[model samples]
Target: MSIFLIFALSKINYARTLIYIFHLATIPAIFAGAALTATSIGITGKVLAEIGKLSAKEGQIIIGAAVLDDILGIIVLAVVASLVKTGEVQISKVIYLVISSSAFVVGAILIGRFLSPFYVQLVNSMKTRGQLLLVSLIFAFILAYIAQVIQLEAILGSFAAGLVLAETEKRSELAEQVFPIADLFVPIFFVCVGAKTDLSVLNPAIPSNREGLVLAAFLIVVAILGKVVTGLAVFSKEKLNRLAIGVGMIPRGEVGLVFAGVGAASGALSPATDAAIIMMVISTTFIAPPLLRLVFKEPTGSPQSVSSEQ
Candidate 1:
């Protein structure tokens, strides 16, 4: 909602005796929305861990909501990418895309639910070392591939795979083995993303890049507000530090960067626009942690966290 409102307001042409801008800037609007839709799970999780609140009520809420946010972000990315690829923004087409993407995710999780027990049993019966971890990874990759084939983002499939694995009794062991691999590869992936960014686009000396900077400013405002609003919407019997959760969700970290990188690679976003997205990511990353620390400095000591009973 924030992204759409900001993009629409930014391109307003009130001088023409109208309250809105023309549809000529549709692609840019999509890119702007896509850039703001991302949230950095890595950063949010780390902040929760660093503050020793991962098991706390507010922390758990942020973690669960952040997972959903990431899934939604990827779905948004797929929709925007499809729009750019088709070069048309028909409302019907968009509706179909959204429904399909959502159904695909839901279906994967449902299927995984029924099959997970059998899958775990099969893996346990295997006569191989690291069978559980190996099967878990293969399942993730397979789901990812299926998602791509079905026009949804691969992240959706991986997330579904995670859902499946979480239902298994060996989740702890799987995490033990998988954490090392993730720790090793995740930094390498981010390094590659950083290396691909063209810094020249951000240089102020370039007169053409100035417009993107203005757009970036607008995006930053909306991005911050969008997440903050999420924090405030925590409805529970136990009082939660809503502001803290909101700030916790602020950093776009790697997710924002990945979306911008994909946009640039697909030619859906111009160099200047990509630079703007990168700047927004950097600003949010630098701002969110300190703000969260400040908000959560003294625990409110709420009676209950967000539990299943709630």
Candidate 2:
């Protein structure tokens, strides 16, 4: 979603002309950002770690919003890539990507509607939870591969599989059974994200020149503003604080960084540029909690605030 904005602003030779004019800069910026995204145990760790403290209401809705952002990020990258590659603004590809994505969404709904109940029965019948692990992992991988084979994003495939499984009778059990794997591999993903960022450059001890700070400031604005608008995506007045909900959903985490990584490796961005984008991510994530908390007021009918004994 932000990438679409970036691509658009870059076209105007305005906001991000720094990025477009020096294609070299975008190279490393993209990878470093990706490494931070896919590799960093980012906001995922934060969200997971916050389990139980927030309402069950909090966990489910927050996670759903994040997943929405994740899916949107993937679509943004695919659409941008198509635009760049074809040079024709192929309306056909835009249609295809949307149709394909919708198909995945529809397919997942069907799985939940039909296939998941069968899975519920199967999981229920298991003697030990171990077999569910094997079966689920295999299923997820197969679906992911199928998505890739179909010229769709693998994460989309995997996410679709997860979403379907999420709505099943045994959603809680399934998440619990596989958390071991999620814990191990997931952190590496986050750390790898951190690994890509050489913060040393930002240190006053090194590349910490005034210019770097100035540039970092600019990037911060870009990053923060980029996601702030996404809050508008929420039009609901029920349950959660819409602004907080939107703020909570702002962290770019894995997918944004992954796009940066791809762009860099493919010579789309330079190292310094990649670092700038990473800074943007950091600012946005860092800003999320405070902003969210600021906007947080227990909604009408909220479990705690409105119902509390005054």
How many residue pairs clash per model?
Answer: 0, 25
Candidate 2: global Cα-lDDT? 0.55
**Strongest candidate by lDDT:** 1
lDDT of 1 by residue, 189-271 (tens): 77886777776776678897666666667668767987787567666778788888788888988888878877777787777
Q: Candidate 2: where are CA atoms >4 Å away? A: 1-64, 78-91, 123-129, 198-216, 226-246, 262-267, 297-310
RMSD for each of the candidates: 5.9, 6.4
TM-score, one value per model: 0.82, 0.66
TM-score of 2: 0.66
Model 2 lDDT tens row, 1-310 = 4433433333234223444533324323323323222212246336434432245454445565555445555554544443334444456876787677768767766866787767767766878748777767777888778777766656666777777777776678778977888889878976886787665555555553544555567656545444445444444555545454445656665566666554544445445555666676666667765564445543433455423323
- Which one is best on TM-score? 1
The 10 consecutive residues of candidate 1 with the worst lDDT sum are: 11-20
Show where candidate 1 strays beyond 4 Å. Answer: 1-24, 236-238, 298-310
